[model samples]
Target: MGSIHHLIGDLPHRSLHDLSRRYGPVMLLKFGQVPFIIVSSPEAAKDIMKTHDSIFAMRPQSEIMKIITKRGQGLVFAPYDDQWRQLRKICIRELLCAKRVQSFCAIREEEAARLVKSISSDQAHLVNLSKKLADYATDAAIRIITGTRFENQE
Candidate 1:
């Protein structure tokens, strides 16, 4: 069993970097008995992501993710297999086709304009571009996915 509570209490990214510095690039961590391999170095990440893509293509689904994603039915969280391949093909052929993507150009441009307007309006002090960009991206994605803008978002 791993100290998940402790991990949650600490700054996860910073803690991971500290661990990676103490250990090597590839460090095996146990999160509540589930082993997680952390690859810190770019060369190691490239090896896994590019060279042996098929071997580690599937994402590790947590219990909460499984529940939220309805047993991993969507393309983003689905397991690597024939079913996943078929789902990916459908997404590429239908949802992500050139015409379909082009249809959302207006939406993207509108969101960009909104972001620029918000930034320009907040010219009194140092504007937090990171937070603004995050909000913009979230709103844009929600609108694109649900066909409705997020209401009362600050």
Candidate 2:
């Protein structure tokens, strides 16, 4: 609880901004028992993420994350190790490559058109634009992954 007392009431971002203004862009803080390095500035964030990334590459694993990821089997939760490196390489080469992403352009366009049609079709009622956009995103992702449209989007 080193700096938790100073962060009460006000929004966390605002508190952090004030603290950073006084303490500098990068500061170490303790919440309960965990030590967190708060990086507020883009330059500091870039330095930490790009230059010193290896030092911070291993994420703090939680019980829930362990259960959800089957003991860090996936890239997102896995420790920075051989397995994580392999998974990252595979993701870059397969799922996130330029060619693979370009291949999904048609699906994205189709989904956008469908979303527009859906929104315009029910002009009589007030549209829940947020829900519709979320559905559109889900539909597009499903189409990209399964090569088929999601049914019952309503």
Candidate 3:
């Protein structure tokens, strides 16, 4: 009986998709200790995004995210106030501007060169190309974001 209750209490994740199809687009799910509200349709998606943008803009203050981001600086966890607006403006006008965007081209070229070198260095066996490519992508993004190559650092 306890096992049955536990199983039943689990969130509908992929399994719940079918049940939501039978019932409706929006549904509540509880997977053990976590809770989730699933939105499964295009119309439901637009309604939440457009009509209730500000209503759902706030994030649930999670402890892990707090430790990682130092409790949300700009857009992600900001209260949509003046400071958030100013930071957003700077990101759009300065950080993401045309000149700043061009700075990433060099980083991309370097990361790509490293990836190609890795692939060519050992091609005698059945290599897991997928894993290699994933590593390449992660390294490329990290390098671009932080201006530091993570591959050589660790």
* Candidate 2: tens digits of C-alpha lDDT, residues 36-73: 89999999999999999998988888889889989999
Measured with C-alpha atoms, the lDDT of residue 33 in candidate 1 is 85
RMSD, candidate 1, Å: 4.3
lDDT of 1 by residue, 1-154 (tens): 6845535755888788878888889988888888888999999999888999998888888889999999899888889999999998999999899999999998889999999998999899899999889988888888999999886445
TM-score of every candidate relative to the true structure: 0.72, 0.71, 0.69
Question: Pairing residues by index, what is the TM-score of model 1?
Answer: 0.72
Q: How close is candidate 3 to the true structure, as a TM-score?
A: 0.69
Q: What is the lDDT, from 0 to 100, of the residue 38 in candidate 2?
A: 93
lDDT of each: 0.87, 0.91, 0.76
Distance (Å) between predicted and true CA of 67, model 1?
2.4
Ranking by lDDT: 2, 1, 3
Instruction: Please give the range of 10 consecutive residues that has the lowest summed lDDT in model 3.
Output: 1-10
Query: Which should have the higher lDDT, number 1 or number 3?
Result: 1
Best by TM-score: 1
Candidate 3 on 1-154: residue-level lDDT in tens? 2112433545735556666777699876666566766788999989999998977777777888888767787576776668778888988998799988897888878878988898898889777889888888899888877878775553
Kindly indicate the candidate among 2 and 3 with the higher lDDT. 2
Model 2 lDDT at residue 6: 77
